[model samples]
Target: MLALVLQELQKSKEPLSVAALSKKLNIDQSALEGMLDHWVRKKRLIENNAQGEMPANCAACSGHARSCHCSAQCPFIARMPKTYSIAAGERGTDND
Candidate 1:
């Protein structure tokens, strides 16, 4: 079942939301999130949220990124839907 998640992500032309993946795999969001977390920990999957940073002057931070507690899940802003992708460097070519 974990492998199936990787397969779906690998074959996708664009990022897929957790909600869409849950429906496609007939699994609940909670279970799907665990699997995604596993892959992310293994450095195979990149959660989109993990790659983003709030600018120091963004309204959410109010020009205080240095002191703001607005880590990835800042409540002042709405988060993007949960999504993951194979890390760029991990998608090795057969020739390599």
Candidate 2:
């Protein structure tokens, strides 16, 4: 299962979401998360915040408001989920 996850990460050009991967790999998202965490510990995978950082000097941006910008009164916050990708120059082993 770990190997399969690694393979999927390797093939994807962009980071993948747990929900998408769960469907693709036929594994539960919770279980897949644990496996992804294992690879993160092994330094074979990296978790990234899909949402980019907010502007530094935005007076109202607390960086934790969960909204895109603090003062814009954005109708919806873009809640980007963490995505997983394989580490550069790392390869998965069949025995993993």
Candidate 3:
């Protein structure tokens, strides 16, 4: 599954939303999120946080991303769901 995820990201011409990846893998969004995190830790993928792109409603975010509750209703959050891509140095490498 990790390999498949890496392959998809490698082949994508642009960043992909978590929802799209979830559908492609036919996996629950939450579960896929966990798996993506694992790949991130392994340095096989890069997670796009979309910083400084916060919505106006994120004023109450408190700057604690992991614990922030505003994400659910934040427009920017909806537009960028922790997008992933192949690591820069590993780009186009078959070893990913």
Candidate 4:
């Protein structure tokens, strides 16, 4: 049953609410909540704050990699380079 829940979560791109997951898994809402709480305690899943309620994603931003803007303003931005790395073997030296 736990495996089934984890599988569903893996297949979903967006974080699902407990109610939605319960309906999809055909389990009782309260039971599903208990299972989710267990997973949270195990650190397998995270609980986010959404308007004072627990959500499946973080409160600050959505989890989509392409859509997130936090990286642009991130503190570590200065540490990253603008160019992609090329293999040394793929480039010719000045001796050529």
Every model's TM-score? 0.63, 0.66, 0.62, 0.51
Top model number, lDDT: 2
Evaluate candidate 2 by giving its C-alpha RMSD to the native, one decimal.
7.8
* Local distance difference test values of all predictions, in order: 0.71, 0.72, 0.69, 0.51
Q: Looking at candidate 4, what is the lDDT of residue 24?
A: 84
| Model 2 poorest ten-residue lDDT run | 55-64
**Which residue pairs show backbone clashes in model 3?**
none
lDDT for position 6 in model 2: 92
Off-target runs (Cα >4 Å) in candidate 1 are 51-79, 93-96
Alpha carbon deviation, residue 33, candidate 2 (Å):
0.9
Candidates arranged by lDDT, highest first: 2, 1, 3, 4
CA lDDT of 16 in candidate 4? Answer: 66
For candidate 4, give the lDDT of residue 47.
52
lDDT of 3: 0.69
Candidate 1, residues 48-89, lDDT tens digits: the string is: 543335543344553344544655676556445656777776
Better of 1 and 4 by lDDT: 1
